[model samples]
Target chain A: MKQFQYVRPTEAGLAINALLKDSGAKFVAGGTNLLDLMKRGIEAPERLVDINRLPLKEITKNDQGFNIGALTLNSSLAEHKDIRKDLPLLSQALLAGASAQLRNMATVGGNLLQRTRCPYFYDTSMPCNKRLPGSGCGALKGFNRMHAIFGASEHCIAVNPSDMNVALSALDAIVQLSGPKGKRNIPIQDFHRLPGDRPELDSVIGKNELITGISIPTSALKHVHYLKIRDRSSYAFALVSVAAALDLEGTTIRWASLAMGGVAHKPWRLTEVETFLAGQQISAGLFQEAGTLAMRGAKAYEHNEFKLKLAPLSIGHALSIASGLVKA
Target chain B: MAKEKTSKASRRNFLKQSTLITVAAMAPPVALKAAEEQWDERLASAIENVPLNIEVNGSVHQAKIDPRVTLLDFLREHLQLTGTKKGCDYGQCGACTVHVDGQRINSCLSLAVMNDGRKVTTIEGLADGAELHPMQAAFIKHDGLQCGYCTPGQIMSAVACIREGHADSDEEIREFMSGNICRCGAYPNIVAAIREVKGGSKV
Candidate 1:
């Protein structure tokens, strides 16, 4: 940990002002990810404006749906009565992420603001555009197994490392952000950006802005499921994960939204597959076709060709579970 | 008239008492302001030999500390509470687990001022005076720890897990306890210890 000034502001307004004023200061909420980056010298700030005391820990129901405060811990949101009942996919996704203790301490705001968990990003010796703003990407040619297959630019190849974001995208969750510019609501899909020419722009958020809450519509998808594929059962990020929700009328699918993780720079929506699945009879072959369409635009590195294949399987499994083709 | 006069005196006394209570209630804020003034008087970014008024394990200590010091370091180095191990100080490991305000959290990840005015319960604070916490006793009986570096954190997490109702079975316990990495491979015994409390098994 580097030497820095610290302030514990009970008010969000004051915290934001402090963040905007300081030339090199960052907001600390939960301190799960940022603190780690700081310790490893990946993220350094001259000051830290702590916003943990702000009342951003509520899960309330509005006319639109559920509004979850940004400071709400991941474990609390995972076990929330509304999230568990109304958004089972989100609950399942949150459960699959990290360990119990981290989940207990990690906030929803921090999770949304989480950076890539690429081993290359963690090591400062390596070249990463997200870390260093393009000294050239080391993962492009070396240790590229876990790199993304979709939305990869020449500068960076790492994947978006959030399982919760995948589910939130599937449910069409909206992120509420606050800053010196006041407040704004962004759709979850548009919240995370792709690795375009500028891979450093991971999201449409400014440095001084803080995520205040997330809103998910109270939905009856008929069936919802979250599937995470990884080397281990727990304590590991997903290799290929899918969050799928489907509206089934008898044996045929009516409406569906599918989002895939660990395969793209952001949570990917398989809209082509969703369009194909609507009014089609659910079967293994149809599921395979949908999965195939989901990975149509994927560009794989030398080592991560397996992910291109594994990502489809991840989606197929999630589709089956979500459509009730198989028992949950 | 005498009774009315007595009543007036009693009301005056009650008002004075209320004023005193108000000041007492606002003491922490006032004390915090005074402390701030002292910090400003020194007028140095590098405040050598700064004192940290940390309340830990139901006690307070004004320990001299480096301005760059972490709460975990302050506990392990200043207070000699070695129960909080420093495994993967990057917050990857839960070896530095402690309770700040009745909830389990990673101490290494938090700064000392972040916890000021908040109650801290480290692994050393888990047990009553001379009496081991039920989780600690269960771990000892079940042989849940080997080498024991990660034991304190594991025990603290176990306490939280049970209280959070995550200790339903071995699988659940294993899932919930994934943060506390035990290199000694004492997982089976650790599960047994948690089950002894959650499943109500006789150890």
Candidate 2:
């Protein structure tokens, strides 16, 4: 790793200013992903503003639901009584993502800002548009079994490798940020961007902004499931994961929220399928139709063509588990 | 005879001067603390070093280190605590697992300066003098290690797993201990060791 200066800022404003002052500076909380990238020489920040001292480690209740501080560790969030009871999907997803040690070190804000695990992006020798703008995409035609199946452009085909982000999208979570302009709340869907011509940019967050917390509104949807399909049963990234939640009135679905991971540049929220499932009776045929509807615009690459078959099956299976028709 | 003696004297001087220069340049400034009361200016000005006040095991260490060194390197290279192994260096393998503020984390992923003011417990601190920790004893009794490269991390993680209440069953122990990879395939034995330790009740 390259030599760099480290600064610990106790206040949010100071941390933001420290990052804004240096164009090559990065705010490091857990250093799980950032340090890994630095070790690989994929990222080299001249200065690191350690924001672990900032007062953003609380999980406070609000009129809406809950506002989780940015520095709240993933393990703490997963084991929180309220989160385990009310937002079990989030807890399950958080636990399902990394190991116990990683969850203990990773923070809520750091998880959202984690980079993709695309092999091309990590290897500096390879030409990746996400790593270096117009360098050319290596995974577009190369071994792309883990490439994006949705919201992908000709420039990039990398997917967001976060299990927590998929659950947040399904829960209607809002990202709270404080920047030079002021404080603002961005919905989870708008926070992460599709890999368009600007594949280098991961999120809509500004260079000077600090993620304060995440605000999740209360929901009537109690039945929830976060189904992560991977090569192994644990400690591996999702191949095609689904975060499903439903508000059921007896056998009929009153409301629903669904999102997918490992198949898109961002959390692919199934709004159309969500709308279709509302007011529909829960049945095998209905869920099968919903699964088909969810795959309306999904496009697959050469190595990931199996996802076309697996994605629909996962959707149906996840919905079945979330609706209590099948045990997860 | 005079010319040969003169060249030999110059060679002796060159050797002495180079040895002194190497020691001044390469060794940590803490090594020179006993020899001089004042800090070395030439060594301090070569590279920027951050002041780190970290509590490791049970002792507090105050030193100036390059900001780039990881907590794993600090423990192994600086503190001379080589019990914690560095497997992948990346967070993928858990050979560098250590407890920071009571929670286990991959030391390789953490910077030493970032751990300022934090209490860290490595494998070296697990045993109490001659007495071994329950987890360490269980590992030996159950033959949980073959190569033993990932033992420290596995034992550390196992201790935290039981404390966190995730070691109730063999399945839970396996899932929680999945982070530490034993390339020799000692997972079944490791799980057996953890189960035996948990059966005793309380970590």
Every model's DockQ, to 2 decimals?
Answer: 0.26, 0.35
CA displacement after TM-score superposition, residue A232 of candidate 1 (Å): 1.1
The best candidate by TM-score is: 2
Q: Which model scores highest in lDDT?
A: 2
Give stretches of model 2 more than 4 Å off.
B1-47, B201-203
Off by over 4 Å in 1: B1-54, B62-68
lDDT of 1 by residue, A1-328 (tens): 6556677788888889998876577888878788888888888766778798999999998777899999999989999997788788999999999877778778998888789988888899988888878577889889888889888888888888998999889999999999998999999999999887777778998888989899999776858889998887888888899998998889888888899889888998888888989998888778888888888878998988998789887788888888778876
For all predictions in the order shown, the interface RMSD in Å is 14.0, 10.6
> What lDDT score is found at residue B153 in candidate 2?
97
For each candidate, C-alpha RMSD in Å? 12.1, 8.8
True contacts kept of 2: 0.79
Chain A TM-score vs. truth, each candidate: 0.98, 0.99
